[model samples]
Target: MIVKHGSTTFLKVIIFLTGIAVLALCVWLPEIAIRDARVHPDTAFFLIPFLLCAYGFCIAFSVALYQAYKLLTYIEKNNAFSELSLKSLKIIKKCAFTVIFLILLGIVSLRVLAKVTGGDDAAGPISLCLMGILATSIITAIVDALQKPLKNILELKPEND
Candidate 1:
């Protein structure tokens, strides 16, 4: 059975956006925060972790998005879910967890640091966006996992043919 490749274009665009977002969050944002650290230590603490997660997210997101691209290509060729896809998905899942962990740790650390240094909002929209992105990736992993059984079933050739 031939697989479809129509959605790959969509995936590419998403991957591009995510990459840009990572750059903005990781490199640019952290630098600004660090530069402003003398004036705002509390801000720097939060920004540091945000940078870490952003870079991490960049690497993880790239891998997953690339794998998705590869998966689409494989589908175009009517290949089953190869080890590549499975490995990629596993990495993606791990990345999501890591992001979540880093995020949680950052929040707790920032909250305490904030109280000591006197800052009201340690975490803003950036944290929320990261959490949302990680959550969505997790859900996607679940749905992607379901594809295994279906692919196996589909791969079974008709005996008569």
Candidate 2:
């Protein structure tokens, strides 16, 4: 029980740090993108829309991280199986799916830009977007899987009460 408690605390700290890092990245990415665009004028046309999409996804990711923090709090309070936890998981799943969808859209945009520009520079960001989609899809699936058992527990709890 003590070890479990310690691990939860550690995880919460890690999550907190991760949330901060995500925020920092969200702020930093636009500046970097702008600088790169200035250095490479040819890509500036697509960079504007990419930065906009990136900012939108950043907001979604931040919300998902906040939900994870709330879920962690529920676990620490011995309410991991409660409706609140389930709701958090549901929100997190939606956020992950939103991210996946946004990345897929970005992939299509990059493809179009590459064809129009007749350049291979978009390949790098396209690969990154594909990986992002895959990662977010997995996160969404895991959260969905968690929701099932949590839903069962939440349903049974009232009868037991």
Candidate 3:
């Protein structure tokens, strides 16, 4: 009905906006890093590895967003419970896991770098990374929970039809 279409449209808009926001962040983060490197040349060494990890996170996030958008499309098309929808959810879940892994690796590297440099105060950044990991893990768990019921429904669908 009208309500269903409206809800999907709103979700699609939100997804589009999220993609744009991420794109902006992707562009802005490097500029900030380069600027900081220029101001504090010694910190430049740390920036490269951190930036690489950040870019990896961005890529995974973008993939998850795209998959979510596709999932919304599937729902709009009355195929919410279909194989394509399931695949999209699976991809999103994997992307969440990737993000969590990247954040953890980045945190470890940051800790090692801090130690090598006589232990700079890295508690703030580490805390942020922990939060990011927690959020990604929750997303992954939610997607996983959804996947099981979806798979069961898919299995039962054929029998019903």
Candidate 4:
């Protein structure tokens, strides 16, 4: 059975809490492990950029979470066609677009940073991941845009049919 809006609201809160917890862990890890650099200096350096990417992901996730939240609220109130759901969907779309843009920017920045830091090795994974994200986001956004209006129309009741 599909979870209802209220249940979804609870899941959204869990998502938020989990996001916050992961962010906090990232922030705390460096300090907590600073003294263990005997074999993990690289871990610390990587953590900085890891945290950056995590925050970027968190931003995207927040957009999605809010969209879910608004959609759930609309479903619960029997007013799914209202502007709030649309607004939330628009925000989600914009956030997805921004994520794609930021991924491109990150690829460029990573290339520059790699050149400066003399580590061509690190660029490969980042470039691969960013390309994947960009491709997926573009496809997902297009599909969502195409199907959403149809979905909305179908949700309407046929008069005296």
Q: Provide the global lDDT of candidate 2 against the true structure.
A: 0.85
- In the predicted model 4, the residue pairs found to clash are none
Using TM-score as the measure, the top candidate is 3
Q: Give candidates' CA RMSD values in order.
A: 4.1, 2.0, 1.8, 5.8
* Cα lDDT tens digits for candidate 3, 15-105: 8999999899999998999898898787689898889888998999999999998998888888888899899999999899889989998
Lowest summed-lDDT stretch of 10 residues in model 3? Answer: 1-10
TM-score of each: 0.67, 0.89, 0.91, 0.59
Show model 4 residue runs off by greater than 4 Å.
Answer: 1-10, 25-57, 131-143, 150-161
What is the Cα root-mean-square deviation between model 1 and the actual structure? Answer: 4.1
- Give the Cα error of residue 89 in candidate 4, in Å: 0.2
In terms of lDDT, which candidate is strongest?
3
Candidate 2 clash pair list: none
TM-score attained by model 1: 0.67
Tens digits of lDDT, candidate 2, 41-137:
9768888788878888888988998899898888877878788999999999989988888888899888888788785678788888888888888
| Tens-digit lDDT track of model 1 for 1-161 | 65445666676677678767766665676566667787766456566665665576567666666666666666666664555555655565666666566566656766676677775665674477566757866666784675566456545644425
Which stretches of candidate 1 lie above 4 Å from their native place? Answer: 41-50, 122-134, 137-144, 147-161
Please report the TM-score between candidate 3 and the true structure: 0.91
> What is the Cα-based lDDT of residue 101 in candidate 4?
64
Q: Which ten residues in a row have the lowest lDDT in candidate 1?
A: 151-160
